[model samples]
Target: MSYLLRCITCGEEYEPTETRYTCDKCGDLYGTLEVIYDYENIKIEKEFEPKGSIFQFKDLIPATSHTPIDQSIGGTPLYKFKGLLGFDELMIKFDGISFSSSYKDRASIIAVNKAIECGADTIYCASTGNAASSLALTAAGTALRTVIFVPSTIPKGKLTQLLVAGAEVIPINSTYDEVFSLSLRVGRKKGWYCRNSAINPYLLEGKKTGAYEILIQNDYKVPDYCFVGVGDGTVISGICKGFKEFYDLGLVDSVPIVIGVQSEKAATIKHVFDKGKPYTPIIEPANSVADSISVGNPRDVIKACKYVESTGGHFISVRDDEIIDSIKEMSRSTGIFSEPAGAAPYAGVKKMIRSGELKRTDSVCIVVTGNGLKDTDAVRSGVEVKTYDIDEAEALFL
Candidate 1:
């Protein structure tokens, strides 16, 4: 159960209590710390059975205590889809069923619990939409106050969730990258606990649980590939970590090839992976219908790239139209509705198959990160709102 924080860039180690976000020596983006557990000393029950809550894997989680939130946080359903999307074996991890109707709840639970554990009264973060709402939902009735900074273009449904949860919403007329920097500065000045998953190491621990659940639900069978939408890169990083942990414990034979799916409009991570270079701050604005993954310069690009490459995975970028089309295709085919970002993985899968990078026989798992209801406006063009009179409706029956 004991662990140490290690800087990914400099390979420096520190006691868990010594630092919060990053390494003091490395600083900022490169200073991002990763939790290194003592795998040799750890032990698990022989008859281990996965449970409905994330707390079931508390032995692997970093927190000593949990928040008093009543709602269940993790344990989303893993559904199988045969002969769908032109794949012989396809599975979707529907994290949209999370408490906040988004996958970000996995990280929010840990962040909120960490805030309380540190005796902090306020928890703040900058998010495109899902993460903000997830944080607000997790800290709703807790003593911790939630403050969210978001772009002005955030969907009304997400804003409504934040307002209903009593979070102090700050809308900035700027890109997500700018808003993120501003939030980091303000959070540091105010000494508030930050829940941004990109910089927070403990939040990654929460996210890795998704990978654990996926493997468990599939009867410990590791899939050939895992496709996830990439934004701040926290979700994919956490997933890779989870699979690595399972592999470390000798539970699974190997890790899946984790493919990160991004919008072509905001494919910073993809570009970096293609170039074989370190992350540099991007100035171009990233505008996409997939608001959640529309990040110009992801802060967690380093870890995201490292983790993906370590598992022999790569990045794929899909067009906005492709993502929109996949939203409809996924919903009609599987009865599972996902936001644009959540559907990006499906689009990427189609693209890869067309490019011959993916084969129809390969077992694939697409992670649906958020619920479709989070951004109904993005799908307006693909759907119709129709009204018919009683007589007109009856004519169709004839």
Candidate 2:
């Protein structure tokens, strides 16, 4: 289980104790580090038995302790949909079933544990919604205090979750990029543990578990492609890392082509990917119905682009209307309700299929990142209410 932290930007390596966040030479988001395991020394069982929580993959995770604050942090179901979306095989990984009703719980649990392990009393994070709520929910009952900085545009449902979890929620009137910078500055001055998954390398380790679970659930059968909603790019990067780890371990034959789904209104990652260069912070404001993925300047853009490109996957952006429509379509077709951001992958899938970019014969897996209830207001137009009068109902029936 020995591992070293390697800077993704520069070829700098450091022991875990040397640097906890990023490399000193290339500071900031560009210096984001990744956990590099000694695969040769690591061992796994030939008959891999899928476990309930992410702790089952302790060997791959950075932490020494496998115990989690929330037991139901991982193991979300991978529901299959045959002939849906006109694809030969389509599967959705329902990650919103996590404790916080979002895929972020996977990272939050580990980040909180890391904070406690480091003897930190407070954890600071900047999120659009899901990550903040997930951190708050995971840090609850623990000695660590959660301080979340969110944009003013965050949905009420997510804010409610944060407050209920007792986290000190601060809604900034500025954009998510501004809030992220403010939180980082304040957290650093206060010496708090930064739990922002984009910069905090360890948090990515937790998200990778989802990829592990997907492969395990399908009996080590790697899908042809995986579509994930991208905001700050941590989730997709972590997923790619997970598939790579399994492939390194000789568990899976190949990794899936990971397609990052983004809202056209907030397509920072997509823009960066298309540019074919290092990430440069975007000044444009990101306004999208999918609040969770509306990030103008994603911190994990470097890793996200690198990992996706490594898998021969490309990024795709969908319209807000398409996202809203996909939410309803996915719900009605599969009985799984997802937030606008969560449903963006489905929208991307439809776009790809329509443009002939995706083959109908290929098997696809869409990682739904959050529950629809997280931001019900985003899909208000999709819901219909019928008020029935007893007399009218009876007369119509007669």
Candidate 3:
């Protein structure tokens, strides 16, 4: 089976060897390329029990390399999260276990693998934190060099991971959007491979593997709804794409409604969704404790909005305080430590409950996207520190 790169807008097909991210005619950055698979030739005996890792579904993936830098990219556990806000059937897709402790590893692994296959030596991307760390780590495992451009205010925990991975980290005194734009320019100028989400269509192919894993792990049980915290809208888009592919392939009965959760400060996609039709993103200063999802201008807005609306889903935003509260509450209740963005879906769920949007009987799955330790500052701020002396051990115990 083989795959080709096709422009989602102009519908122009290109050989897999073509190295552009968008349609050559349209040149609309948001109108990015897509991975088109030749499904008829590929036959899957059983998607449930993959022979290896995500590569078991290699027929669907668009990469030429069967060998991955890390084989443990997929197969994350989907645990039953019982009795959350009186919902009987609630599950959490814990993707924090990805090699780099973030869901972005799904994309990084594929992007880096494709770069190596294409004979590129250096891979570049711009991220708030998780994407850069994942890309850096994956690139380090291979002979590829990694250059990450990040905002100066990136979390300390993620910054440490980038340095430890030996990637050339450039901290720019600017916002995420600025850093991302600069990365594109520099990558093009230096003839380096760009691993940025929404820019590289193969990244979505990798991320969509998580959705394939989720559906397979559930025994092909399609949930009524799927919730994800949206930053650049890549994750939700990938999940939507995966579900659609499975549904089309007759692997699943139906596709779940994908709900995109975003922070109030970073509600660019949400605002566009609410307006309907003329989907133009409005940029603003995105200030949120969930740094990972704090993007003023989502790169994959067009596809993300289309998928959510087509599936009868919604786009909702919660305040920074709400995100922090959800992080604390979810960590205590489920014993799953999640970063603010990872737990933002729960905040959206809370809003749904209050507004009567989500019912008590709806079977839903919330994607826990990243490890809480990635943003220790957010965790520390949520927890209260009490000073106790060894002499007053009784008080401490009490």
Candidate 4:
């Protein structure tokens, strides 16, 4: 790995051998370590092959070893919206096609590999659903063990996937933030490698591969705007980091305006951005249909806020009904079934257009982060079902 872990707060740099996830001097509860690449001396091939999804761009990632998995983690399709929802210059990155049916698969791939590289026997993390399922499946594929703590209120479908993947699932009767705090302490005490979002800098490296894939897939053209659903905000931060790297390497001339989507029920980070206030944890009862992107206190809010502001992006919050409607609209228009959180980006697009934040001529990309199958309850709520006999069905069709 041609990278070093740098503290985002203190600017202290450490060798890749250091396993610590936080700055020694920074007292913030959500400190993030960033990966600084040796871009000048790094090697890039004239013709790159994406044989192992993100690993195909192995030289860009921070892992020292390359272990291929059975399932691919990146290279999801970039499809045009085809004038869907009255937007012409819009595209969607279907990250839901991942093995775990979520964008977290990309990060899990790198986190599991980093675990194996560091010789860690067990890894632990706090997730609501997608992240846990992704980590569990990736660990299982790589012959690694994982302990995942999630809120008991997580969707039944995602919970089942975690258990079936053979992860030590501990569902706490509390909010995601509570589970996250407890998991961090327990992971440190048990000597298990913590793969928590924001804290694990390598995970960001993994998520950033999607940005690389988007640029490459679009023939190296940067979109005018990119919308992503934010929970703990690590995914968007990683994407911004990826685009920044490409810009520094002179691959792309400019970074896109990376907008963040949040459910109004749990839009703490969005509120902060909207008001232009100092960082403060907003703890409340967050009950949103888009459960995947519902977090009261995002762990990587600092990086997320900084990225969006610096890149000319804005944070938008949508109502639960808007999210549900977006799910059906996107599925109907694009034939891609997306979970509430995945559909959140579409809702953001609609809001941007209505509020004049996004223009009709501006190119856009909505990062559909997960599949609708992960949250069938939300999908079912938006769909209608009926059964009829053959004769009745034929008569209705006729």
Candidate 5:
């Protein structure tokens, strides 16, 4: 009924201990969500349905509860980014517009359901923007009280979403780690059910749905590469797990390369992979206008690095100017509006093309993790859209 969930760095096995968020031995320093399941008793005789998500292969998910409660969050749109430079079959599975305008909604759906099954009256998490917005909205729907701690750099659109929802949104005027540390302490001290990605392992199950959907949409074929821009590494690790599961099932002949994207200014995952060791986050972060990806000492740096090495992938870093360009390009071309970090994967795609790393035959997918409305200000370098009477507007155009 269970599998030994081990630490990625030390390989220390663990049990669900004392309602704690992570292993006492490792202390979850890498902030990776590790869930191991025993597939021994799972019937090899039975074939898993490939069309749907966790519903198709519920056993692979470590969530204690299986609810068909919501279909809107996990099954996101998978589209092709036609005519990308240096890549012929380049495609992107845009997941930013999930029910709540971010991929975090999927994880919250699963985490909150588990919280409900465990008889929890309250759910808590720490977020920068999208996660907080999604968690608050999900909690409101589930009739659970949510307490979210977020960093102060979050944009107005995201703040507006939280304020409109049923949550006690607290803005922490510090780095992402500080917000997480405070959330961890309060969740432990107050006996609140934790739903934050770094602390709760179950969140990974929901994030894996994005990967699952991508495979299903491609007729059970994995892409050549999957580019994910990281904030906490939860999304990328969850995706790695999903691909590993597919490889185990023989559904895919090979797994896709997992490319981790980061702002060149704040490239923690890149540093650890480049160093070939268990990398620690430096005290200071490189400054970037993309406030969403501005993380110092990301919690999942170690796991992210391991994913890159084992999966035979590269980490691509891009400038904030590139991110802005991506935002504009994505909006103009695909009608997809994304925040700065959300646009970062597109920037990675461009960077790959410029470096001659992309191939014409290789099928690629870049996950847009959040909506542009999350950080509208980041894309405000140019004049905003204006609607006016034809007489005046035409004169200006002339």
Candidate 6:
């Protein structure tokens, strides 16, 4: 590994010997720990072909020379969005259909690699939905002991995914915050490796693979803009970090204008962006169909604001009805089924077009984050699923 784990605050890079979970000096203020890479040795060529998954660009990542786990991750599709926007260059990078059906799988694979390298057999984590499925499915590669704690109100489909992955699923009737706090305490006492992004510094590195894959597929050219939905802001930050690496390596000319999408109901960042003030410590959370972006208190909101502001990116918020409609629109137009959170980019793109926020020539990419299967509650009502005998199944359609 040629990278140093750096604190977002002090700008001091730590050596491998000094690698700890968080920054030693400015742990509280930094808010996020960033992995700084040695970009000088990197040579970005237009001819390079990425591996079938994220590993295809291993040379561009901060992975151990001998990756401990060789599981399939990354390499999701980037499809063009049609009809709504007049822009010819807008595309939605599909991340929902990851190995276990969420962008979290990218992080899960790498997190598990680190855990396996450290020789941890048992793993535990707290997630509202997507991360739980990712962790369990990735951990199933080795079939090592894994446990997932999620909110009791999680979609039945997501819960079923965890069970099928051979993970011990525990539902806490409390909110995600309560479940997260309890899991941390229990995890420390039980010696289980914590897989939550709140505690893991390398988790960002894993999630950054989405950016890497897109760049690789596009011949290493960074898009003019990248859009993502924000939960705790880890995924958005991850994408930014990936582009930063390419820039530092001289692989790309400039970083993309990072666009953050949040549910209008939980539009805290939008409030900060619109009011032209520093973040307010307290904000109210409202209910929305995009439950994935429902976190009122984002752990990395400070970093998110800093990244967007420094890179000249903007935060966009969309209403719940718009999100639901975007999900259907994207599926119908692109044939890429996505959940509400996954369709968030579509809503943002539409808003941009109507407001004349984006130019016609700009090359843009939207980060669709979760599978449509995760929350069938929204789509199940409108779409019909038919069951028939084998003999009549094909004949009826004909």
List candidate 2 segments past 4 Å from native: 46-51, 64-68, 278-281, 396-398
* lDDT score at residue 188, model 1, on the 0-100 scale: 91
TM-score of each candidate structure, all chains considered together? 0.97, 0.96, 0.96, 0.94, 0.91, 0.88
Clashes (N, CA, C under 3 Å) per candidate: 0, 0, 0, 0, 3, 1
Across 1-398, the per-residue lDDT of candidate 5 in tens digits comes to: 47556676677677744364566667767534477777556653235343344545566665554344465556667877667655666667776667678888878888787788777878888877888888888777776789999988778888888989868989978877788889988988898888877577778777877777778777777898898887677788778777877677666778889888888887766776677665664544655666666777566666666766678986878888888999998888878888888888889978887778877788898888888877878878664787889899889979
Q: Write the per-residue lDDT of candidate 6 for residues 295-375, one digit (tens) a residue.
A: 765666666676777668989998888988888887877788898888887898888878988888888898998989899
How would the candidate models be sorted by TM-score, starting from the highest?
1, 2, 3, 4, 5, 6
- RMSD per model, one decimal: 1.5, 1.6, 1.7, 1.9, 2.6, 3.5
The regions of model 4 sitting more than 4 angstroms off are: 28-30, 43-46, 49-52, 277-281
User: How far does residue 35 in candidate 5 sit from its true spot (Å)?
Assistant: 0.6
Per-residue lDDT tens digits for candidate 1, residues 1-398, read 78889998889998876127888897767778899998987776424444467777867987754566533878889999889977888999999888999999988998888888888989999999999999998899689888999999899999999999999999999999999999999999999998986678898999998999899989999999999999878899999999999999888889999999999999888888887856553444689899999998788888898999999999999999999999999999999999999999999999999999888899999999999999989888768889889998999897
Which ten residues in a row are the worst by lDDT in model 5?
A: 44-53
lDDT by candidate, in order shown:
0.88, 0.89, 0.86, 0.83, 0.75, 0.76
- Cα TM-score of candidate 3: 0.96
* Number of the candidate with higher TM-score, 5 or 6: 5
Q: Ten-residue segment with the worst summed lDDT in candidate 4?
A: 43-52
* Candidate 3 C-alpha lDDT tens digits along 185-283: 999999999899998888988888888888888888899989999989889989999898898888888999999999988998999899987566677
Candidates sorted on lDDT, descending:
2, 1, 3, 4, 6, 5
Report the C-alpha displacement of residue 315, candidate 1, in angstroms. Answer: 0.4
List model 4 lDDT by residue over 103-137, tens digit each.
Answer: 99888888887788788889889999999999898
Error of 4 at 24 (Å): 1.3
Task: Tell me the spans in candidate 6 whose CA falls farther than 4 Å from its real position.
Answer: 16-19, 25-30, 64-71, 81-84, 272-283, 382-398
Off by over 4 Å in 3: 50-52, 64-68, 395-398
